[model samples]
Target chain A: MTETVIQTRGLTKEFIRDEFHVVALDRVDIDIRKGEFVALMGPSGSGKSTLLHLIAAMDRPTDGEIRVLGQDLRGLSDREVSYWRNSHVGFIFQSFNLIPVLNAIENVELPLKLTTLTKKEQREHAATALKLVGLEERMRHLPRQLSGGQEQRVAIARAIVTDPDLILADEPTGNLDAASADEALNLLAKLNRDYGKTIVMVTHDPHAAGFATRVCHLEKGVLLESLQADGS
Target chain B: MMRISNFLPLVFKNSFRNRRRSILTVASLALSLCLLGLLMAMYEALFYGPDPTPAQAVRLVVRNKVSLAQPMPLSHEQKIRQVPGVEAVMLQQWFGGTYRDARDPNNFFARFAVQPQEVFSIFSEYSLPEAERQAFVRERTACVASRTLADKFGWKTGERITFVGDIFPVTVELKLAGIYDDPNQNEVLYFQWEYLRESLRPVFGGEMDMVSQFILKADSPESVPRISREVDEMFAVTPFQTKTESEQAFVLSFVSFLGNLKLFMLAIGGAVTFTILLVSANTLSMSVRERIREVGIMKTLGFTPGIILGTLLGEASLMSLTGGLIGCAFAWALCAMISSAPIPFAQLRGLALTPLITLICLSIAILIGLGSALLPALNASRRPILDSLGHSG
Candidate 1:
């Protein structure tokens, strides 16, 4: 039996702007299983990022509940949620949010600092993660010292350093050129395939979506349909 | 628990991100603290004795009851010595004069006339060579000068120096019989009372027996108050009544002429500290504002809010502590240099930076640093993750 990595039941999110009510996600029900690469696609303000944020436990739903790795996010305290995020999930941002002052390895080691791992173990894990992302040679370089694709690769290394079961990436290749975008997409695909890591990414690029095993389209706070990788 | 080793580098690097602003803030803080330290030293020098000698407690000064300007009769010295608790008495008269060839005409140094035989007995703190002490007592025109004063004027032991008196209308010359060294005393020229009295007799028509003040050494520190009371009461019936006080009180009374010196010092120090706090807090706020997104990223990476606050506070403390040390050391060096030089201000003659004062200033710097970071750290830690991440810079 494939374990459910994420489950969202009747999840709704609302925002109030200028005294007007805005519903970002309405009656959204979604599920992702272990080892599945799912892509969330939509136009601007269509609730794609909103749904991803809900699943990642970065934001709370107005109604219903979200369960990630069999743990209810709604029941967890803020501190527990932070600990859960550290142990179970990793994130890659659109802009490759790497700290400017830290080197590639130090940025990768950031998540590991929260764990009970010894300094040597953390260093080893960070080094291995950088190697997995093919950034071993650039491990000592700062973010400004790397190209766009290389910085994204470093961000990927940071995301995978703690060996998280779920990796949430929001437009990981949005700022990259075609070549760099392809490189980053290929890296993410490899992470899902070779490591059996479940990934849920939000992106507008069709090509980037094609790299995922399944693509879920959202429109006007509603999920339209999900397409399998085989187009079946 | 975040490891200190891991957190320190981040704090240090982030603090220097805006190099120009950080440097300017630190420089301003350093300059202010330095001025504060110097002012503290000045206050200590004025109200409390500059040199912390324990022997000063047993010493007493007998002055005219009305004011320092009023002189007392020389007969008071005999009556003061007859008191039961008085061990020794010396007549001291201020001789205000300018050296005949002084480079700066307005430059003033302490000059006094004292009884020759009582020099060593009264001021035992001054150490003079045995032969020089004997020679000073033998010659009527011989005088003794502090080593610092002798070095300043390039006067050898046998050299004769002339002074044109500003108060008394006379010119006098004396041979330098000895040079004494004492940390408690400043660079001064001391000549025989007989010489000053004889020089002034003809000008004043044989009525020059009055002296500025009398210094008395009590038999023991426990007897100082009793001796002071007895001496004051003895002169209560005379026309020239006397006011007797401990040496410390005498020095403090001189400082009182400036009016509430301690409060004045506290006001200046408080103003400087408050200004530094504001400047440091503003700088920290700006730095935190610029790094909102970075803070959000750290939070996403599983860093606790407490850790974020600690990191910011750590940066602030490091900056403040660095500035404080530099400022205090600078003030200490400046005070030392001024003390070694020929300054005419007697109150600041031996001004020094005591260890207690240095520690106080450094502690204040740390407090300032921590105090300045409180609001900024709290704001950064409590900011919503979504909002922080959404911030452009």
Candidate 2:
């Protein structure tokens, strides 16, 4: 039996803005098994990104519980959550959120600094991760020097450098051109298919969602449907 | 745990991301610290002389009880020498004069008529060759000039220099007997007391037996207060009552004539420090605000809040220290240049930065950095990762 990597039950999040309570997610339930590439699709006001944030433990749920890798996230302190997230989850953002001051190799090595790896081992792992993303020649290039596709690849290298169990991407290809978007999607597909790394992505584009094995739809902070992948 | 070395490059790069703003902030801090160091040196020089010596603690000066302008009778020197703990006594009279030079008519230097034999013994710090000391004693109309004074006026040994007296009603000529070197004394000329008294005797009969002040050396530092008290009490009822104080106190009283200069300097220094603190803090705050997204990226990469705070504080401290050192160096150079110039103020000599002053300047720089960055660092550290990541640019 494939083990469930992420489990959410009755999870809810509400944000208070200017004394007005607006619910972002309402009692959402989600389960993602090991090695499953799940795409969360929703419109502008949907809770797809909010759900991804909760699963990555970047935020706390207002009510109910979330378990990632079979450990209850609510029981952990803020510091423990941070350590657990570093070891268990890798996040990719729409803007390719690589630190501008650092080169590709240094950006990749950032996450591994939290691990017990020696400096040499960190360098070796970072180099290997960059090479995996087809950016071995561009390891010394800063983010501004790289193209949009190359920047996303470097972000991918940074995400996987720690060998995390799950990768969470929020609108990963939203800022890319069509060709670069296709290239970034192909890399995500390869990462999930070959390395068996579980992925949860939030996107509005059906072409981006076509790469995932399963698609979950959300509307008005409610999960409406789960659809099987139509082979791309 | 992240190694500090790993964070240093990022911290340094981030500090100068806004190069213009950072450069301006550093320049402002450096200039302020330079001014602060110079003011402190000036205050020190005014109250303590250029370079106070250990022997100054054991010496006392006796003057008129009413004011320094009034002269004391030269006969009181014998009575002061008789006081207990008095090791040596010398009579000194001020001679206000200017050399008869056409190029510089008002170039005035300190001229005093002191007892030739007792001057060297009383001011042990002054060093002169044996031959010159003998020459100064052998010739009744001979005078000794400081090396600085000799260089300024281009006087040589055996040369006769004439001074047109401004205070006394006599034109005096004397052979330059010797040039002496002392770190604390600057641009002074000393001649025999008898020459001045004899020259003025015919003009003001009997009244010429007055001296400006008397310098007494005690046998030990422990007996200075006792000797001062005994000297003052002995002349309490006399027409020319005396006020006795240590050499340091006498210099301090002279500086007191400037009226609260130390407090004024402290106020200016404080204002400068506070102004720089606000400027540096504002700069750091703006830097943090501009890098909100970058901070969030680091957070997502597993950097703890404490780590972020330390990185920001480290950047601030490094910037401040750099500015402070440059300012101190500039101030030290300025002092060296001033000391070599032909300045009439004796207090401006040896105004260079001391080790204590350097340390203080550096410490203030660090404090400015730390104090300025504290609130901004805390705000950056406490900011939620989601909020930071959500912030645009």
Candidate 3:
């Protein structure tokens, strides 16, 4: 039997702006099992990112339950949520947000700082993660010293350094050139296919969505359909 | 749940992220603290001089009742000597005169005509050889200067110096008999009272019989207050009324001539501190504002609000502490130079930057750092992660 990695039943999120209540996500239902590369497809402001945020425990839903890795996220305190998120989830951003001062290996080592790992062990784990992303040569380079694609690779190294159970990426390739974007998408696909890592990536690009095992479309705060990718 | 110690490297790196801004902020803090330290040192020296030694505690000064400018008749010294608890008595008259250059302030120091026979017995804190003391007492034209004063002017034994008197229309020449050392490094010169009395009598005749004040020592510390009262009462009905006080109180009264110095220094210090706080707050606010997205990134990586706030606060404290150390060192060096510059003000002769002053200044620097960063760090820590990530800065 396949285990469900993420389950959201009638999950809703609403934001209030200047005396008006705006609904970002309305009672959306989603189910993602282990080792599934699910791509959330939608236009801007379509709440696909909001669903990913809710599942990642980066935000709270207004009206339904969200459980990730069989743990009820709504029951966790802020501090508990932080520790749980650090241990269980890896997040990547579109802008390749690395701490400008730390080198590539140090950026990858940030997640392990919260653990009880010794400094040597943390460096060893970070170096391995960087090697996995093919950034072994750039371990001592700062973010500004790297190209956009190389910086994105460092971000990927940081995300997976903790050996998290699930990886969530929001517009991971939106700022990259075509060749860099393809390299990043190929990396995500390889992680899911070879390592059996569960990934939920948010993107408006259909070509990027094609790299996922399943595609779920969201429009106007509503989930339309979940379809398997043609290759899968 | 992160230990603050783990954040030190991050804190240190962030402080230098914008090197120019950090340096400017530290320089401003250092300058302000330097001024504050100097003012505090002066205040400490004036108000809290080292506690009186055992011999000093039993000594008293008798002056005119109304004002320091009023001269008391010489007969009061005999009556003061006869007091029950009085151990010894000496007369001292201030001779306000210039050395070589009357126009230059650096040529000024304390000069007094004192009873040379009683000088060593009355001021037991001073130390010199017995031969020098005997020469100073026997020769009416001889003068004794403290080692600090002698070093300032390069005067040696047998060197002749003349002073053109300012208060009395008379000029006197004297030979240097000895150089003595005192703990406070006071720049003072004392000459025989008979030299000044003879010089004055040729001009003002019998008016030269008057003297400025009398210094007396009691048999013990317990008898100081009683001796003061008895001496003052003995001269009450006479032509020369006397005001008697302990040696420490006498020095403090001279300091009072400058007005309330404590309040003055505190007011300036408070203003400077407030200005530095505002400057520091603004600089830290801009630094944190520029790093809003970075803070969000750290939060997504599992840094709690407490951790973020503590790290930023730590950065501020570390930067300000560096500035404080530099400022204290500057102030200490400046005070050393000033103390050796031959200033005539006795209150500032031995001004010093004590360890207690340095500790206090450093603590204030830390407090300033913490106070300046509180609002900005709190705001950054509590901001919603999504909003922070979305921030353009």
Candidate 4:
């Protein structure tokens, strides 16, 4: 039962643009168990990312309820949401968005900066995270100095630096080549298996999606399929 | 907070990022401060009170029947001294001379020839110790000078000082017997009255009787106006009409000219403050624009509206204080250099470091810094986070 780490009841997200309403999510209802690794699959216009954003508390749903890790997110202030994000949730963006000025260790240390963590501890954590991504030797390298896969690995290192319970990755491999995608996915899979982290990913590639234990699809703004994992 | 300590250096780095603009701003501030300080020092020089008027019981100035430029007779001193409140009478005459160094002329104050014994008594800025006074009166070749004139020629006690005489036409060589300073009366660089009297006994050219006004002292303040009236009445029958007034009133008349100069300086000070305000505001605006996204990031990172606003303003104030300090230091340094230069009016004393002046000047800088920062900082605070995250657009 794992206490259902995420539960949404008839959740919806709608954006109003120039007198027309764009429904980005429609009547989404799901229960994702604790420690589960799930993939949300759809093309660009699908509701995958919107659902991911709602569950991550990055934005509020237009209607209905979302309970993430047993806490209803609608009542959280932006500050509380930021606090929750820093302490409880992790995000890996598709672009591997690393601040260009900060070196790999600093980028990994970004989330911890808002905490009362001592400087030495923050460095230790960032170094350990970078080492997990096998880029410890390159901790001092800037983002521009790193190859695309290394930068993506640095981004993953940043995501879990705070030891968040749930890792929400938006197209974690969308920008990487096949090898880098494999590496990013392997890292995510390792975080789930090794650290027992709850993982939810939004991606367009089925090959990338195949790495997850379950797959879900959306058509237009509607969730169309929820299927159990069948093959590698 | 780490933010505040780190934030100031970041603001300073903004100035360095665009060195040209920062230099222009600093230069303008320094120049304005320099000019303001110079004006204040000059005005102080001009209004220096009767610096130690002689304690002589009864002495008076006998000027014209009408105005100051109209000098009165040496004979008028004799008649004025005979009046009830008067004690002793003697004469001194002004010899307005340019310096021997014609390369920089107009370095003129006043030189007077006096009956040496009565000279120190009548005008009394001409003080020598009793022995030196006796020796000075005994020898026509001897003269005494104000401390300022002595220092000007690098002359010490017993050293001979000379000036190219303008009216007398002879290079007057005189001994500096002692240093002089007076908080009242006038500072007169003087030689014997016999020189002007004897020298003029031959020329006898123009107004033979007139001494450039006379210095008169009353037994008390109550008698000043009455003594003044009788002196004017005595000269009324003569050709030169006398306008007698208290010494204080005489010095006060020059205040009108100085007042206009003060008004002009105040206008410049106003402009200085206003210009710095615009410059600092522009600097703040540019700085805020560059960090618009960081503002958004800060907001999203849980910093409050007040935190953003306060940080912006604090940075601005710090900038102003730094600029103010530099400008003030520049003004002080310039004053020191000018004080040491060969300028008579410059040796005119004032503390180059006046707290009120620094406070007011730096106050302008801080005010300008804060005022300029306000709109831009407020604008940055109210901007939507979405717009900020998108930097270029």
Quick one: best lDDT, which candidate? 3
Candidate 3 vs 4: which has more DockQ: 3
Q: Give, for candidate 1 chain B, the lowest lDDT window spanning 10 residues.
A: B46-55
**Distance from true position, residue A140, model 4, in Å?**
4.1
Expressed as tens digits, the lDDT of each residue in A1-232 for candidate 4 is 3679999999999998799989988898998998889999988878898898788776788999999988899999766776776678888878776765568887787666667777788789999999999999999998899988999999888888889889999898989899999999999999998899999999999898888888888877888878878743
Using DockQ, give the best candidate's number.
1
Measured against the true chain A, the candidates' chain A TM-scores are 0.98, 0.98, 0.98, 0.97
Residue B245 in candidate 2, Cα distance off native in Å: 1.8
Q: Candidate 3 clashing pairs? A: none
What DockQ results do all the predictions give, each relative to the true complex? 0.59, 0.57, 0.57, 0.19
| lDDT (tens digit, per residue) of candidate 1 on B251-309 | 77877777887898889999999999999989878888889899899888877788888
DockQ-wise, the better of 1 and 2 is 1
Model 3: residues >4 Å from true position, as ranges? B1-5, B104-106, B128-131, B181-184, B230-241, B345-350
Q: Distance from true position, residue A29, model 1, in Å?
A: 1.5
- Model 2: per-residue Cα lDDT over A71-175, one tens digit each: 999998777877888898999999999888789999999888778788899899999999999999999999999999999999999999999999999999999
**Cand. 4 TM to true fold:** 0.74
Error of 3 at B292 (Å): 1.6
CAPRI classification of candidate 3? medium
